[model samples]
Target: MVQDSPATRARILAAAVEEFSAHGLAGARIDRIAEAAVANKSSIYVYFGNKEKLFAAAMDRVIGDLSDAVPLTEHDLPNYAGRMFDYVVDHPEALRMSMWRHLERPSAGPVVTELYERKLEAMASEAHPSGLPPMDLLVLVVGLSGAWLTSSRDLLAAEGGDPYSAERLATHRAAMVEAARRVVDGV
Candidate 1:
């Protein structure tokens, strides 16, 4: 066994993110991850215990970066949604990992639950024009934020050339923000 080191751990985490995002937890291969990370396959098991734990660690890293990049703004959900759209555009892998998590591991881990609870508390502390419950508003805003990304590529392509072009992205971002505003303000 190779001596454990922080650098090897970091490489493993990075490789795991790419692997899990592309194949999900069930389909991900530790051999591929080890090759990508230039570490022994056994290192992953040593560091993360198993595939499930490794997936969780990879999600934690992605979620940590996402939350740090785009925090929840309870009072201005529209702007918050816009920011989320922007973040997803920059880090599409994060979205893919999240989708995979929902598909294969539907339950929220403690850290994810804690983060969600914090957002719920923040939303409940404020009153919106729509008067919808905090959880409902949060779900709506988040859904709108990622709606474009989750849309079928064929559907988007049918609209025009390069659905992900700068112009299209700007247009979708504006629409998503407006939809979020309508939900929050009932306008």
Candidate 2:
């Protein structure tokens, strides 16, 4: 049987997130995850299936944390983007995981789809006044908040500035909020 302990599962998930974030699904090794988690490889397979499933579980856990920590509303799109921005900044690997999933997985799993459904429904209810479809607005909010975290280095290089400067981060964050506001206003 699997280790079947919450401690072991949590450890594996933590290790898996780090591994998958650093190397992605194909490059991540089950042996490395097991070593990092202080569990055996067999235990990981039993608890989390193959490497793909482990990656999915890790993504799901973090996404759930974000959903709980940053619920969205179309009326408060800017603040919603700000919260998402903060969360993505604190956990940049989550964005990396998302990008890797899009590249590596053919389609999202049912659980991930369900999470989107709930958020879309909530946004749709409030988005009628904004005149933009909920999906479009949702994409804008997440993309605006996360775009900097994912591409700041290249952007900074083009601007001839430090990518990790506090000033840069602050300016980008404020811009994200303004962009979100404009997206709503434009609609």
Please tell me which predicted candidate would have the highest TM-score against the true structure.
1
Name the weakest run of 10 consecutive residues (lDDT summed) in model 2: 106-115
Give the Cα error of residue 75 in candidate 2, in Å: 1.9
Residues 1-187 of candidate 2 have per-residue lDDT tens digits of 4545888988999999899888988899899999999998988888888887888888787667767777766468789899888887788776777788789874543256676788778766663555878888778777888888777566659988686587888898998899888887774
lDDT of predicted model 1 = 0.88
lDDT string, candidate 1, 33-92, tens digits: 999999999989988999899988999898789988998877888999999999999999
Q: How accurate is candidate 2 locally (lDDT)?
A: 0.80
Question: Each candidate: how many clashes?
Answer: 0, 0
Candidate 2, residue 116: how far the Cα is off, in Å: 4.7
lDDT measured at residue 57 in model 2 versus the true structure, 0 to 100:
88
